[model samples]
Target: MIKEFREALKRFLVEICEFVQERDISFPQRPSGKYQVEVRDGIPSIQPIGIKPKPDLRALDTLMVGLRAWEKETFGNIMEIITRSERLSQAFLTSATGDLISGNRTMVFPKIRPIIEAYFAETNSFDFQQETFNRICDKVEEELRRLPYCSKILQCPVVGIHVSPNCSDCCLQLESDLQVRSLSLEEIEEFLEYPPFLPSFFTTVVEMKKDMEIFKQQLCFPEKDKKRIECVVIALRLLFGDRIFVPFQIERGQGILGKVLLGEQQSYSLEQRVVPPPRLLHIVDQEKYTELKELYHCISETLLERDRAKIAFSDNRSKQRVELALRKWSEGLDQVSAEWKLIAHWIALEGLFSPSSRQELSFRLALRGAIFMEEKEVYQKLKMSYEMRSRIVHGDYSPDDPQLTEIALTTEEILRRILRKILQQPRNYMPDQLEEKLLETLTK
Candidate 1:
């Protein structure tokens, strides 16, 4: 029965933590009760009172009296009750027992004895002791389990080494979101200190509270409104030790599509004349137009080499040789600032941006404008191909907005088409190719 009592006492301590955790309360910082501690034959019993004054010693005294009566009605005098219900104060004393037999002295093993033997001597009866002892032990164990565990460290065995769940839930959520496959122990430790997951667990709780405020406004009627909100509140309470008040603010959704469309409007109205001018043809005079015309012809004639080679005209004009010289002379005109302006003005005046309508929402409109204004439909198709390339340069239009996705995809297609055209012999083999061919001819 004594053995059973000892085991019960140990379990009693363990149960304190369990009880405290269930109630979401903590154990007192210091020991309490007149029986601040207690002891059995060779073991100690400790009772924790969380941040409270000593418990009623009257209850402990009643228990000790009952224990004493049980001992007296059973094994009697050897049992002494210190009267303190606090388990940790139960101090056990062990002493060596000596025996003398047949004129010889021998030392026996240490025998545990009550340090207060005088108090135990007053007890008298000897009966069925073990049962009585068990009764007293059961009472003590019950009382001990009602107390809180003195330290969080003691609760470690019950819950794993993880920090409070409230604190860890955010990272746990983020990891799941980012599809982080696995994190080594070292990675977890580092993440505990870094952004997106860093800061004390309490900080996360406060942040979650703030998020809740935002959600309250954004999700006016969430599916599990109360439960979801309460979960966040409770998590915050556990994560951060704070009295929190969260505020809600609406987020604005202004985007590139809207901006670009407005820009197109402004462009046609010439409202943003102060902003940088669009990168398009800007030619003004007839001379510049003529120069641009000749340059385009020179460039196109050189590209029509296969057709030129097939034709056998023994004319003294030597059109091929003359055209070659014209192409070289036109190349200089292509670089002239005046010709570039003509092309720019022609593009701007092409009615791509309807004066009465909003500006284009995307670079596609810009590309389409350049295409329409160019002299040839072939040039229009060639310029149209580059829309996607320009769109990519613009980057993502807006956060959490899918409108740009279709535009981006279309832009990509235009770029691919333009790239294919650029790779064609005419667009691909440029003046650079001509210069190399001419150099070869001169060397020959």
Candidate 2:
């Protein structure tokens, strides 16, 4: 494999040099008197006497085509090994070499011009070229063999929560790679800035004069360790109520600021705009933080257990039901409208109860949920919210209706409580078993 790789590298170097030399020869040189003033019908206009020709990249295109063919045939295994190395991956990302090899020709010529020049500077000797190619191959092999001890830091801003000054150093280690901790003021300021641009004269600097104003607390994890962290965020929402959320933007959707400034009904395409950063509204003490960590652990463990069961029993209905409920729960929290949020939560409840038929689904959901939570009053709340859900779905309810807020809140609370109880004891609360348990409760 090493011998083959070295031979391939030498051939690539030779072709790259030839391509660069051809490009240099064909590249256009500046012409004197390139522009001239011409008069047409008593009107004077500036016109170009000689137009600058665009660079012909046919040689580069051919080189890349051949390189891609070589990569497809003989470079797959070596690339896999290189990309898998954390140190190598970081190096590639920083150096833009990854972009270069992936057929991004924009920066390829500039990047390799110096190296090609150095190779040419030598006395037209094959030995020097071979030595340089050997060094390149050896460096790549050394990097691949070296043990990766470097770790990647991924920090996500936590909205609506602050770490208490008393526990500034308290890092909630939720998993081997995931944790919640407070960052320094400097670090928090990094996220608060607007995306870079040339500012207009109208742009004014507004200072945040208050102490500890910005959200400094963040969910930190190692690279690729963010799996199921969204579920953990859902768990936190359940624990802390709806006072918090991590804000996210849809790439293909209209910017929120654009919609607000322009009327909501007005359609426009504005991909970039400054928006308010999500704020920290609540302070979390050590005790509450501990509870949050425990809840996160419980939810994460339940998900892992369900995943394992899903693999073992391919047709595991219980696993499917639980996952569906969790997804709906997460979706509900993501909604911007109160009506949609209520409907999403209700759908999650339906997923949990799995009513035998659509007939009397409200009653069944209420009964099953109330029974699961050992709270009789929960049934009345569930029934009323389900009725409101029906009204909203049928277009009978107005968006301006004052009761929508209260009902949405009530429905979300009920769903959160039911989900919490189910996640707390996953084994005993399987959908089928929970129905049987509710029947047993009714008999008693």
Candidate 3:
């Protein structure tokens, strides 16, 4: 690659020399003689008596000055070419060499060094600038092999390119390079001022964090109540399947910012951990599970607690619906009196617990088919949920304890998971009844 650049440089300089010599050859000086002056109308002109000076050669001094200027210009052009070629060659060379070389030694074209040496020997007065250019190109190419575009540029066909290389850097060659084009300095400033131009990975992390915030806010109180937090995690196991602390750890505090998961603590970026699944909350593959787990932890930690008692709950219709639904299962339990938050949490638990009896199984299947799916992640969540159900059903748990001062706090944990799943997915959890209502509204 260096050889090609050096060859190009040599060709350009030689061409410039040819142009200079052709325009600056000495001509026979015109015989020193006086010229006859003639008057025509109001103008007077002088005519040469002997052979006139050759137009091409008469301006030798000016041509010599221009030739020198062009020599410098040609050298500058070489520097520019060499600099650009070196930049691209680095990209190409890195890609071509892979990780085989220790460093950038991948770009050193040892094959072309001899050719350069021969060129200098033949042209006794070689351009010192060219030699320096060659050394830098060779050294950089050999040294910085790991640079993103180094391997890419080295492989690009410079000669065949139709346009000027100065125009723009192609993304293919940039290798994750991001450039913001703006017409004016103000526009550039605006782009730079925009805080969102973090790395693509960072942008994704921010989004995941936002979702987790909303989930936490939703989980803070009963489902009927809404919290101010922005994001919520829908499914915990959907996020952290099997292991608890492998991908991320939960961070909790007083404020919204405090609840945020410190994704930087992980070895991989959030992007690596939480790649959005093809379907929300559908934990079919590993990526889906990873995304869900990260979300769950974040939501759980950030979830706020409601300050006031259950008075500011959702409307009576929702309350009545809850009462009717749970009346058959738990006779004494007032699903209606239960705070909307608690009711939503309980509904989520019922959905996740996978009721054992045939009648209960039918309800579980109905809920699963309705809002959730029967995936591995969901099954694992069901297992976790049943542990809570065991404490609530088997043990002497209280329903009227307002503060949930009962046998255990499994309800809260199960509620958190269910809420996270809800936050992770709202549309899926949208009741079939609600879908019908929406369709009815649309038709109306």
Candidate with best lDDT: 2
Q: What is the lDDT of residue 356 in candidate 1?
A: 31
Q: Which order, best to worst by lDDT?
A: 2, 3, 1
Error of 1 at 193 (Å): 13
Weakest ten-residue segment in model 1 by summed lDDT: 151-160
lDDT of 3 by residue, 123-184 (tens): 22345366544553444334323322211000101100111123342111111221111123
User: Residue 130 in model 3: shift from native, Å?
Assistant: 24
Query: Which candidate, 1 or 2, would have the higher TM-score against the true structure?
Result: 2
Cα lDDT tens digits for candidate 1, 109-160? 0111121221222223212245553454455445534432211000000001
TM-scores of the candidates in the order shown: 0.18, 0.55, 0.20
Q: How far is candidate 2 from the true structure (C-alpha RMSD, Å)?
A: 16.1
For model 2 the TM-score comes to 0.55
lDDT of 2 at 213: 7
| Residues forming the 10-long window of minimal summed lDDT in candidate 3 | 152-161
Better of 2 and 3 by lDDT: 2
The segments of candidate 2 whose C-alpha lies over 4 angstroms from its true place after superposition are 1-153, 164-170, 193-227, 248-280, 284-286, 297-315, 433-444
- Cand. 1 Cα-lDDT: 0.28
TM-score pick, better of 1 and 3: 3
Q: RMSD in angstroms, candidate 3?
A: 24.0
TM-score, structure 3 vs. true: 0.20
lDDT of 2 by residue, 274-372 (tens): 323323355667887777776766666455553322122223565567667776776676676789989888888887886667777788888778877
